[model samples]
Target: MFEYSIKENCLTNKTILVTGAGAGIGKEAAITYAKLGATVILLGKTVKKLEAVYDEIIALGLAEPAIVPLDLKGATKQNYIDMSSTIASQFGKLDGALLNASTLGELTPFTQIHEQVFSDVMQVNVNAQYLLAQALIPTLLLTEKASLVFTSSSVGSQGRAYWGPYSISKFATEGLMQVIADEYENSSLRTNAINPGATNTNMRASAFPAEDKEKLATTADIMPLYVYLMSDDSLAVNGQTIKAQ
Candidate 1:
């Protein structure tokens, strides 16, 4: 678990949108950002889960959060564009966006991979992100300083057997981050990826059911890096992949 003294009110006047905010790392990050005074937009597939997170934030006396129910697998370019428009109308500008929602298709041998599974994984993990980023860039540019954090995996960095489409999608994610980072080198928006190593999340449990869960770090433990990336402290850091452990 990583720890850092969070500067009080570091994210005052900022608006950050987090995908997959219903649970796991995304949920924790949203809570942390709200605690630091950032207005958060919680996006997820399940309305119930998003509402639950919303209620939790309210109970903690954090800033009120907005909920946007969306499933990455089914969202189209127009859907993302509309979402961006709504955000612009409501918040005026976006300070950051965490592309945290992802789907891990069936893990199997390359020869046995199902086409539908592959397509679904790529849709959620890759295409959806590209579309969302494209639509949100205009609003992001409105900020004096903005950040975009993409969720990546270790297997995406190193090809591993049985990792299947998830790994390939992560590689694409890394590439996307680099391209965006380079394109925005002189701009206010900064882009990067973070690998939350072995966190005790549902995704981890699904990927490694046989492993001892107790040995893994909790989602809250890896929040410092998320906070740092969202803060002005990491303004100059771009095109880099950080490991949060």
Candidate 2:
């Protein structure tokens, strides 16, 4: 499982939607899927960043990708439903979806947590994911085999001192994954979560301001696990939380 390589056409004839695709792990995952022959839908809040990724994928002569500018913080259920409908009409089915977008609200003490801050965190991390997954389930079921990967965190499994809302949101994410996984236990769609441990992303930098970025793994280095989870080879592996190091 650790030594697998994504075949050049492993994801050929498939379509994948990746949230937070404008930067960091999301951007890298989107590009990786395109390189492995999947038509990728890049969803993010920034149009320019998504376009940059789109252009890079095109330049690589990989699959052509689509761009969806979405702000999960403000996105409504209807927006997700409409997007899902459009995807169903255009692609017929969605092969996979990476729910990678997240917000790292203020890392304050739990005692000082405010209402708006907590709501904002939960909105992007939990509420939006629930809505998006609900909308995309129909399209995912249409696929021969489909994967739904959520981005989890270390704090989700074990509470930490200063992680606050981000931590709570991740805990909710894991709970959601378990609920959805159980719901689809007998179906073709599989749901799972991954904790990209201490990677070299802006989020990491923000979370650990004093840490040395040079000591951490780059986004590219951790993609094999992401690719493996999204590929057909992992068809039997579902409903589990994995660490991508």
Candidate 3:
């Protein structure tokens, strides 16, 4: 499990947007942020899933969360613009964003990777991330200090055999984080990437169906890094990849 020294209620008054908040790490992160006092904006393709998370936060007596049901694979520039505009109008500023939505394209050899699968993976993992960040950068700048944490993978940092477009998309995600982090070096906003290695998410299950799920770290186990990256504790951390395992 990851470790970080974040103080309790460190996220009070913060407004954080979390993509793919319908399930898995994104859901856990949203709940965790709300518990720490941040108003969470849950974005995912499934409204029901987002609503379930919202109810969980409310039931916990945490800050009320907002939901944006968006499928990144089909999301457009205009879609992101509208979301950013809504956040700005509602929250006045965005303190952080967990760009955690990603898809696992088939784990096939490079030569056997399907064209549509490759495009879908890139669209969701790369294109949507770029468009969403481009739209939200202005809102992030409104904060005194802001964080943008992009989800990465072990395969992204070091290519693995038979991972196909999922690995490639993650590589692009890392590049995107570095580019944005460098460009925003002098600004109030900072960008970083986190690799949640070998977690017990559905994606991991899909990748390794035969593995014992109980042996892997759960989403709750690795949330310290997520909370740390989004909190003031990591205000000075930027343009680097942090491992959460």
Candidate 4:
């Protein structure tokens, strides 16, 4: 598992947005960030799930979390604009964002991949991220320091058979991170990518159904790096892809 010694309340007064906050790593990261003193904005497709996470945060006496039920597959660039506008009006500026939401298309042979599945996977995993970043970059610049963390996969770093469009989208994700990171190297904004290798997420279960999930690392196990990247501790780290496993 990854290790990073983050100080208590390291994210105090920070306003961070997390995509895919309804479940899995996104849910855990949202709650964890709130506990560490960052006001979390939870964006996902299901209101019920987001509300559950919201309730958990509130119950724990953590920073109040806001829920935005958004389906990334259909969200337009204007939707992201409105989201950033709302964030600016309410929080003044966004301190960080975790672009963790992604879709896993069928694990089939490269030739067997369907067009619609390919498009759907690319829309959520790559295009939505691009739109979100485009909209949030301006708000992110308003802060003295800001971080944009993209969730990557092990297959993204290296091509593998049967990974299909999901793998291709992740490769695009890594490229997106590096491009944005280089673009803002001289600015307050920082972009980085994290590969949560072998985490016991629902998505992981879907990808490797026959594998024993008991041996996989939990979301809590890899949270140190998540918190560290968003906190001031990693302000100098940019454009690099870190593996959390």
Model 1 lDDT tens row, 1-245: 44656798899999999999999999999999999999999999999999999999999998899999999988889999999999999999999999999988888999999999999999999999999999999999998999999999998799999988999999999999999999999999999999988999998889889999898888888988999899999999999999987
| TM-score per model over all chains | 0.98, 0.98, 0.99, 0.99
How many clashes show up in model 3?
0
RMSD values for the candidates in order, in angstroms, are 1.0, 1.1, 0.7, 0.7
Q: Per-residue lDDT for 40 in model 3?
A: 97
Candidate 2, residues 49-146: lDDT per residue as tens digits? 99999999999998889889999999999999999999999999999999999999988888999989999999999999999999999999999899
* Model 1 TM: 0.98
lDDT of 2 at 52: 97
Candidate 3 lDDT over residue span 59-107, tens digit each: 9998889999999988899999999999999999999999999999899
Q: Give residue 10's lDDT in candidate 2 (0 to 100).
A: 85
What is the number of backbone collisions in each predicted candidate, taken in the order shown?
0, 0, 0, 0
Q: What TM-score does candidate 4 reach?
A: 0.99
Q: Candidate 4's error at 101, in angstroms?
A: 0.2
lDDT of each: 0.93, 0.93, 0.94, 0.94
Candidate 1: C-alpha lDDT? 0.93
Instruction: Pick out the ten consecutive residues of candidate 1 with the lowest summed lDDT.
Output: 1-10
* Superposed model 1: Cα runs more than 4 Å off: 1-4
Q: Tell how far residue 177 is off in model 4, in angstroms.
A: 0.6
Candidate 4 collision pairs: none
